[model samples]
Each structure stands twice: as structure tokens, then as C-alpha cells.
Target: MTRPHGRFQQAFAKALFSSTEALDPAMRELATQPAFAVYRNTVMKACIDALEANFPAVARLVGSEWFRAAAALYVSAEAPRDGRLLHYGSGFAEFLRGFEPAAELIYLPGVARLDTLWLEAHAAQDASAADAAWVARRTPEQLAALSLRPHPAARWAWFDDQPVFSIWERNRAQGEVTDELAWQGEGALLTRPYDTVTWQGLTQASCVFLDACAGGATLQQAAERALAVDVKADLAAIFAGLLSAGAFTAPSSSPASNERTP
Candidate 1:
């Protein structure tokens, strides 16, 4: 039932994915076998390299050989849809979740997700850091109604059941993975303030607070939400920390758009 072009495409795709597979019969006479093999190898290498670049922590957790094998399978199963390799591995975290061989590492998917967030933050559109002095100028009433604008390059808290942020930090420092520490749920906020992507771990209350702010809630509402998360939450410290980190842009009349203050 296959049309002529469709049949040729299916065979060509098969040949493209594997060097050992013969070229489509129609094209076999058009190109040399050696040339096809070289092309296949080059394509596979590029895909593996892209995976490695995006998930260096995953590669470090599993040795290069294991990572390479997994990458190969991933590339074959989930080839890039577009020419942009920068966005190539968006589904890799999900891929890792179903990857049977990685079943032992319950944290791998979280790590991959964090890695993707880091990439996104690094590539996000540039925005000026919010001026902390603006807070001093606002009346208490104005402040209550004022919603904080999040930096374009800032990503709100990402919570995971695994201690993904701790693992990522330790791995980045090239520290030894130890069994001595107890792992628990952790959260991360990724931001690119200057040239480097930075992240900080957050508690459940803090994560709730930031998520609320990112959704366009006023500061008072964000604090109320945080208190709902934990009655003893310290709103002042969280506000100060976010301000110091430049997680937010200038205060705006509307949360959806940034407005410059005099």
C-alpha cells in the first residue's frame, strides 16, 4: 500500500540509521557502499556528541561507554526533528525515565531535567537585572499591589523527588559521590545573570513562593502562599534572597510587562 516516494523514504531512513543495513535498492547503484558507511558514522557521532554536551552530568554518573551506548539507542529511537541541535535533547529526560538499563538510578531523570533547564536558562533572552533600590521607593500600599517581574533568563523552582540539585553541584565540582548523605526531595532555580548559568537549591516553601511569583502573583500573595506551605516560613529572608540573586526584573505595574522606574 506504500506510495513510491514513501517506500523509498522508509528504506532510505533505515539505511541512514544503520551503516550495516544495505542502502535502498533503488539508491544502491547511485552511491558507493563506503561513502554510505562514512555518512552513517558521521551522523551517529554528531548525535552522540549533542547528547553528551547537553547531559554532561549524566555522562559522568554513568561511564563514557555506558553513556555512549545509551546515547546511541536514544539517537536511533528519537532522532532530531529539526536541524537545530541546540534544542535536540528536550525529550531526553523522558527517554531516560523509560530507559530500562538506567532503572537502578532513580535520580537520572531529575538530573537530565535539571540539565535541560540549565541549557534553557543559558539560552533565554537577555534581560536587565531588577534594581533592588526600587523597593525602597514604593509605598507599602503600592508594594502590596506590585507584582515582581521575573528575569527572562530566570527559571522558577523545579522540584524533584530526588536530591537532583545536590547531585548536580557535587558532580560539577568533581566531588566523589558518597552514600553517607541521606537523599531527599530538592528544588532548583536556574538563572543566567551574566555569562554563566547559576542555580540554587530551594526548600518546599521557597519553591512554592517562587512558583507563585512566576505565575504573576503580587508579593503579598506569594508570601501568603508560602505561609500556607509552612506556617513558620520566613517571608523576609526569602524576599531578600530572591532580590539579592536578581531572580526578578524591575517591579512593574503589570506582571506581564516590565516598566522602568524613575
Candidate 2:
């Protein structure tokens, strides 16, 4: 026979979590237990509140009312599995993809992804600056042979004609219409040291070039890859932009790298 405390605990958990409710007494407790009722409501509220606060951009994109509604359903189905609150909604974009009620908001998932990206970049470890002297140290040939390691804060995104940035800017705008389809394909380079997140529309060539560099291509090789695709593309402009933006760090060491550095 179960003690009164044990029975109450079972009922309390059921009352608190939707999944556990069917596992134990429910209706009887709802009618009879005042403390359990209060506890259950408080826990549920906390979950919804945390989700809303952590993913404010997501809430704004979908609207507070709709996001709150979805949040409640999501929380009930997926009790937080970890202690880290910021990571709670990491999988939410995928959840939004299949969420029936959110089907009308086609780009909601991508927006959610960008929000997640922002949070991740914001949490990345502090890094040293990509000083000009670092690049200047290289000899001409070494500069040409240089390979850059991306910062921990780097975020590379690919979108398919999604107006992810437009919506974000409009919501942040003093007065502007951030229609989703108004913008074309976009990509972003997220950095944390300066605490800046800049989204820029990328040409196909630029994406391929940066991607190769990210994959450890040396400067000469990456530029060759970019030019192969678009013969007239300005490799110098790409290097200048990447360098100005502090897009990466120097390679460890190589003799080929020595020819360009002092």
C-alpha cells in the first residue's frame, strides 16, 4: 500500500507534467488538491516563460501570442532535458518545421535557426584579435600562401531565397516593412568579440570561396577555386573583404608561408 506522501508525489507529478498525468491519479486530485494545483500551474508557467525569454527573436517572428501557444505545447511534450537554459530550444527550429499549427509560417524555421545561431555565437569563447601585424609579418609569397582558421564565433549560414534578415531588421526597425519574400538568398558572418552579427547577401562565388577557406584551403587555392567558377571575379576584392572583416586566423607554419613573411 502506498503512503499518503507517495500517492501525493505521484499525483503531483502527473498534475505537473502532461506525460505523467495519465500515469497516475489526475481528475480526482484536480478536484481535491489545492497545493498540487498551485504547484502544477507554477511549473508550467516557468517553462513557457523561460522559452519565451530565451528565444525572443523567435517569439517576435511568430508573434508573442502564437509563440506562447506553441511553447506551451512544446514544453508539455518535451520537458527540459538539461540544466542549461540557453540550450533548451536548440532543436526548436526542427520542431517548428513539423508543427502543424506553424505550417502557415513557412520561413519561421529559418528565422528560428538564425536566432539559435546568434545565441551560439554570443556564447563562444573569447578570442584574440586578427591583428594587422599578424598578416604584415608574412612575406609576399607567404601572404599568397596563407590559410586562415576561422574564429570560434564564426557562423556560416545558407538560405534559399529566405528573407530571414529582412524580417529581423524590420522587427528591429524604427518603421519598416520586413516582408519575408522581399529579400533574396542571404548569408551571415556572426562575430562575438565586437559583439556584432552582420548578415550580408552572398553571391554564389563568395559562398564557395569562403566555404573552401573554412575547409582549410590556402589563399592561392581558394582564390583559384573562386575564379574557376567565375572567370572575371575579383579575388583581390574577396581577400580584402575577408581580411577587413577579420574572417580568420593564420595557419600554424609552413616554408611556403615563409616566402611572404619577414
The model with the greatest TM-score is 1
| TM-score computed on alpha carbons, candidate 1 | 0.83
lDDT tens digits by residue: candidate 2, 37-104: 67777887888887887677778777889998998888877777666777778778888999998898
Say which candidate scores most in lDDT. Answer: 1
Candidate 2: Cα lDDT at 238: 71
The local distance difference test score of model 2 is 0.69
Writing each residue's lDDT as its tens digit, candidate 1 over 130-247 gives: 6667675678887777788777888754544677888877775577667654567887888886678888877777888878888999988988999997899888888777777768
All-Cα superposition RMSD per candidate: 4.3, 6.2
TM of each candidate vs. truth? 0.83, 0.74
Q: Give Cα distance to truth, residue 3, candidate 1, Å.
A: 15
Q: Which ten residues in a row have the lowest lDDT in candidate 1?
A: 253-262
